[model samples]
Target: MSAFLADRDSARFELRFQSLFNAGHVVSFPCNAAGQVDLDALSERERDRYLYARAVVGGVFSLPQKQRRLD
Candidate 1:
């Protein structure tokens, strides 16, 4: 793999879509430092959630935030 792709694959960051009305509700996906998600790397269910989160950004969720993974 290219260095860029390899770096993204090993990223320890996530893109978090926080619910606007719910303080504790969030949908997150593994992502690189720039908040780029690798759709091909996600499972079927996860891909669906990611798409859903993107679709409802203003209505159901806040703008996505890039966060470092603790684990």
Candidate 2:
């Protein structure tokens, strides 16, 4: 979905990731703010925050802070 990724960028990324894997490189998966690794199991609040974060990272949103301001 456009909410997550565009097909072209997504496809390119998949190819790159596959190449890395084929070359025996390990890709570090994404983790949440609390360092949780599972995405599909995220709670409602965590899911919302995660989507906002994904949007920011993918250049779909500008949240101002370069790093998360979690103090």
Estimate TM-scores for all models.
0.87, 0.28
Summarize candidate 2's per-residue lDDT along 1-71 as a digit string, tens digits.
Answer: 33233223322221111121233631222333433335554567766765555554424433222223222
Q: Which ten-residue region of model 1 has the weakest summed lDDT?
A: 1-10
Off by over 4 Å in 1: 1-5
Q: Report the C-alpha displacement of residue 59, candidate 1, in angstroms.
A: 0.3
Off by over 4 Å in 2: 1-36, 58-71
Consecutive 10-residue window with the lowest summed lDDT within model 2: 12-21
Candidate 2: what lDDT? 0.36
> For every candidate structure, what is the RMSD over all alpha carbons to the true structure, in angstroms?
2.2, 14.7
Model 1 earns a TM-score of: 0.87
Cα misplacement distance, residue 36 of candidate 1 (Å):
0.1
Best by lDDT: 1
